[model samples]
Target: MSIPTGTVTFLFTDIEGSTRMWERRREAMQEALKRHDTILRLTIESHRGYVFKTVGDAFCAAFTTATDALESAVEIQRKIDKTDWGEAPIRIRMGMHTGTAEERDGDYFGRAVNRVARLQSAGHGGQVLVSSSTQELLADNLPEHIVLKDLGSRRLKDLDRPEHIYQAQIGGKEEQFPQLKTLDIRPNNLPVQVTSFIGREKEIDEIHRLLNAARLLTINCPGGIGKTRISLHATTELLDIFHDGVWFIDLVPVSGKDGMWQAVAGALSIRSETGIPLDNTVIDRLKNKELLLILDNCEQLVLEAAETAGALLAGCPDIKILATSREALSIPGETVYQIQPLSVPSAAEETQGEKSCAAGISEYESVRLFIDRALQIRQTFVVTNENAPALAQICRWLDGIPLAIELAASRVKMFSLKELYERLGDRFEALNRGLRTAPPRQQTLRALIDWSYDLLDEEERELFMKLSVFTGGWALKAAEVICGSTAPLPVTAPPAWRDFIDPDHNYTYKTEGSIATYNDIKPDLDVIGLLERLVDKSLVIANQTDGSTRFVMLETVRQYGEQKLNDSGKSRETLKRHLHYFLLFVENYMTQVEDVTQNIWDTPIREEYPNIQTALKISLTEKEYYEYGVRIISSLFTYWQYHGSEMEARVWLEQFYPFPDYIQDPLTRTWITLMFGWILSSTLD
Candidate 1:
């Protein structure tokens, strides 16, 4: 039979208490499951339903018509109730939803499939739940014995919008059951999110899994990584698990420990007693309640939050705490989960893979997130092979971070994709702004990074800027060798770091930090110990591959630090040191091969390719290092030839051509003339 293609009805079923039954009575449950499957399969098939998937006594079927789906669900429940199982009786919970869903390889997916699954979970055993769409379909044509009891608007778990549910009563008798398991049964203060939740399915699943094993699970990542949104979404999915409720407490305004306790109390509506303090009242109110507390933006008040979370958890055994911070709370029984950025397609995939076509490029999580937000701005915008590389480049340039991607996507309303990609070289101006309604720190990319940067001490800020001189990434040895210079820096921070409200009462931020207003302080730059600490603080990322770790910054972060270096009037000396290090790196001296050697390593050349390019650009363009720049280009000749960078090399060298007449150095002139001729010949060939 040809599979149902579009505008189909999905019927999802599960055996209530199936897991407990399997554990307690494996053999009996197995036999009961076989009988249950036979009843459902026969009834569904008899009603012209296509069973797409079955898992552990559950069935997900699709029907061409909503009437057929409704009839199948009602028939399956009746058949299961009357079946003769000696000891174990099987009760089936069913859900029916009708919407437009496209079939893929004999399976179905879309919001319809998801809605039906959520509907099925909201029903009790021996009952069938129907969505409003399905109910509207069967409005006049419900069989004589079947009637739908209208269950007015109820919010289903994991669904953003509320659903109008209906209970299908079969056999002409109204069976009494408990209330429909919906979100209204549990109270929550979870904020109503406006935009659609984008990628992070795996992260959300991992968060839930970790929460099941431990009470306190903290999602630690750099700022603007979407921790607050992901934590709220995860809590919404878990509404049915906790009886009391879930509460999202934003700690952005909280500065002290009392403010932290008061925030929780205010969220929970806990009133202070005569002698009991607000903190104690919070504990007393939550002592017996089984609830989830989401503490967001705790990095500012991390110590106070840690103390408050510790006290609350110790007071109540049933309460679980999920926190979002730049660093861990470091309390006992805390499961720290570092949420990484979304998956982005490599530059090679963007151009080389057949999958980079318009429809296929969205397979990358970061690209999908971008496309989702971009659609809101310009619905007609689409990705093609020609523009797919630019789209992939945008996501990669922003390091696959969600907030940065969203901000970049917002520019589709103003600029073309190519203009957006070209403007990303100045990361601050291109991706700095976000939705004005968002929190202060999140309103702009600059504000977000400033929150993390301002938290660093004098020494960390110095090393952070020094480390930015290396492109792509840097190893610990490179950071130690170059950043440990005993120079007392001019400033420890960017011009400004603001997380304040303006006169108009808008909760916005200002992070335009080319304004270099800092006190004169001498912070002895410490590299080795401080780099590790910065990694722990989420200001820096330590990527481990091939059994060796490389410390790196997000390109946005590097840009921020680079902006500071340029503003502080330190780029000449700092960039000179960077050029010298790579000069040795171009030779084999900087690597483990040791000794002053002329032979260059291809692997390091490729890994540090961006740094080499930056060095060449800076040295040749800057007046002080024209000779050294020419020397480095000569050194990279073999590396560039093998790398097929002939066109790129030609472009870089052409900028330095028609040599500066002030140069009287004969050897420099000789090497320059030969290099230009060689590149010109290579290009012609």
Candidate 2:
């Protein structure tokens, strides 16, 4: 008989636990194997099916129709159930799938064949499992004695997607053997996490609730913020609720919207036949089933992911989607859960006297994560009074970001806790090493920030690169003054403006009558809109303080932006603008320091301390700005005295003031001498 091509139904059969039976009774097992082969082949042939391949006690066959395949599977099971072997009983498990395959050399090969074999493996002895495609084809054509029982969706080995499995129940003795082996099984495709999932108890519960409340929930967070891990933990916890099976579709490998549905189809094991449209096949197969789909890393394909999710939610009422991206999908019925960084201990908590070894460290999620991960690299590692503060500082410096913490912790094998704390000053270089299995972006602190940075538009990228000048965070006015450029920008500019204009080119600027040169045009930079966009993208975070909004970049993100600034050779120019702006700010605030309310005066200065220190350091490096640094330092005397930061003030004063260049103006010199004497006296006593 010739092999069938095009759309065909495959029936794969195997003896359940045949190896044990063969070991128990070799002679009887041989007879049983012979009978099993004979019954399966004869039934398949009688039902207009051809037995293509057989190995030992298993048989792989193909039929032209699902009716014939189901009939053949049932007939084979009935014969095995009733056959009287001399000393042993034989039971066979069968599975069938209807899909198009190529006919070559009297054998077939394709996803359909692989799927049918997996379906067969998902069943128990005396049971027949069929793919939803084959079951749908059977429709009203199944024999009266054979009924299809829905076994629900299952993830088979080597298949990217979950398959909706059904079992064929034959009447009489074959009707009752044991429950289908795959019945209690839940489809879990999540990668096995090597390390324990620490912290996020509240987040896990909240995400679970959101998923239940909303059909489409997207976990929005910046890279390395643990969105994927959180979503997996939540999905794993809620697996039993999704009767059809929980499926994980990684969209990182998928490019655009064109491939989104195909990725989903692949994850669901829904292969299209010769003439059928894949999207239509996916919708048809999933419309009635209840399942959860986890779409990971959708930031690169946000629009496509959103569109596909919208389509799926619209058509499939019972299907729920949980996606992870740096931004939201923005579709109707979508719940955007912004994942925050792990909790870090406050300065007060860090300074609190140490109680004991590993004491109170678990209270902060970030600290707990760091400790746990550090122990992975150094098995003897433990948090004690001596190292607890350093650990807290490490977590805080990492902004409690899970990936950052893990990368930092991985270095415990090579560095001491105090050394790690000290090295965080160069965070990008310190936290560069990451697990090899992680995505390229997640391989290092710099790479993760670079991934997010590369996704920005031209204007956003420009703003991000310049905003690195600020140390802690910046007010809108400060950012606008420092980052905004009044000079003309090229229409088609390179990554950095410095890269576009070459000194050798000698391209003289000419504002001619008819055509203006590239250097004569200025692009309007919308600082507000760009900052808001950065906030939306999770690159910048905004905080409302004292009736005004303050924008801040996490330390890791700031380091990344600063690196970009230095690479573009804009560090000095940007830092000049920053120093000039803050110098003017300090001079203006000096007169009001006495009359200003304690809360009001202290808050702004304390917040701006990091930027001020950054500016002062930048100024001391250059002769032209040395006076600006001394003047700014002298102006903050009242701030330091009032805020009880005299020791810190003394340290900065000693570091910069004791330099060679003497004070120029008598009044300024007198004020600096007096303040310096007072701080010195306080410190010496």
Candidate 3:
């Protein structure tokens, strides 16, 4: 008999109505069981997820991340649901608990596992229940949009105390977030589970479709939306696509750019001359082979990544790049797809009554993801009349972001649907407060972004603030004119000292001043260096690389940078300088865009699109720039529509309309009218 080696979280899933299904359609039921077994094993292996045994309709598995364990359970169910078994449908109820269990050389043994197995008996068909600890550990790393329905504390068999359980409700259909793993980013392959994936079916299908057509493709999405999960899933699917072998390059662990190249080179077992850069060596080796390359987490080091990817794309037509990022690398002929959140049941489907709930929205992937994840942890979980509205409200409150949903799901052990609803009502606040000691920035999603802001140096921080003045995406030249004219003052130095002399006693004193005092500061400004520092510190994410280095400001970082600008009492001047900068850049950007017009672009805007939009929106609405707003809009008409900036453009036009006639030129008036007409026409339908 084999003994289980390490302590693990046990997940036992039992198929409900198995006997009836077998009796009704023995042949179909057998086929369904075969499919179920395949999926259960495949999901476990995907996350390096582990399974102990399979007994008839029940499966015993384990995972390291409760989120992953929960996610694996959900994925298994989803696969089962999609399987065609002729007439025998299989619904499973899963129960999981995180605790130390002895893996006695293959056969597992422990009270934690035993308690969880016992809990399975209490579960109704298609439900999931988990211990409180499991919920807490996996909370932060979960996708942002899925909401967990807390079953609250429940008395279970063979346990002296009440166990807290949660059921997940995946909502916010069409919303997707980049799912974050542990921030350590070390190269260690820590065991994890594929907890839940919201949306991305279309993107996944498209990717697989392209897999047959092209050898390399990159999948990009914003942070905290399940990019790693999707990449891993794609790798699993591509196992068949690539008969040679499938491999993954976890870039998060490699500390430097060269290290990344070294990792890939080693993984592919490529040899090169002692002095040659590993990147070149690796490219040379891969140039002649067909391989599937899944580059996980490349948003932070886009330039290095782009260099490597471009080389590979050029040298090796057979190699494919499946990358996950908050932004995309605008390589020529590269296809960019945006992954969204799971769909929520429409309000019409949510009945209003004392026990009113939303049901029958199972067709939506968001709901399916939620119910499927919930059923993996709770024995009696359901999305019926009693909890539908609360569930729906939770999804909406989370902005339908998938990572947010998974985090909320982990809190299920602590609160009920109604209580969870109330807690989420203060999500902005709740998510910010750290329940335990963690990286101060990881306390909440907002704090994570805020932490990035706090790390920027004076100049980088200032540039971030000024850049926010842009209404939409701007060209590199625009950024250069706006932010490059004056370099940001360095935030740190060993106290620059100036020599002073006193003639009376031949005594000397040293005086120090801010970087602002240095005349050469502007001349010595290193924008690229500053950007590299910002990216390294995670204050800003370096996105794509073609000619311009694209980047993004986290919403939290934007807010914090704005606050810094305000506190410094430089808001007015900074805003003025920012406006001037854009004005200057617009002239140059127009030259670049003259051929394409405002509407047609074959590639995505630079990663700095969000920051630019934030800057522009603030200029028009929050800043006291009535006349300047119209001028800014007139300057960047092409940018407004180029970035899908419909709402912001409309608002700018509205703000421009009230300004005196002198401020609104014919170009501004015509653009505003056309934009307004577009908004009205689009909304009427």
Q: What's the TM-score of each model vs. the native?
A: 0.77, 0.65, 0.44
Residues 300-405 of candidate 2: C-alpha lDDT, one tens digit per residue: 8788988899889888999999999888888899889989999887777755675222466656889877876776577666666778788888888888999999
Candidate 2's displacement at residue 603, Å, is: 4.5
Model 2 weakest 10-residue run by lDDT: 491-500
Question: What is the alpha-carbon lDDT of model 2 when measured against the actual structure?
Answer: 0.76
Candidate 2 wrong stretches, greater than 4 Å: 1-184, 273-277, 355-357, 487-523, 592-603, 641-649, 659-670, 677-684
> Cα lDDT of model 3 overall?
0.58
Q: How high is the lDDT of residue 154 in model 3?
A: 53
- For all candidates in order, the CA lDDT equals 0.77, 0.76, 0.58
After superposition, candidate 3 runs with Cα above 4 Å error: 1-199, 269-276, 345-356, 360-363, 367-384, 433-443, 447-685
For model 3, what is the alpha-carbon lDDT of residue 191?
A: 22
Better of 2 and 3 by lDDT: 2
lDDT over C-alpha atoms for residue 108 of model 2: 62
Residue 216 lDDT in model 1?
Answer: 95
- Candidate 3 or 1, higher lDDT: 1
Question: What TM-score, to 2 decimals, does candidate 1 have?
Answer: 0.77
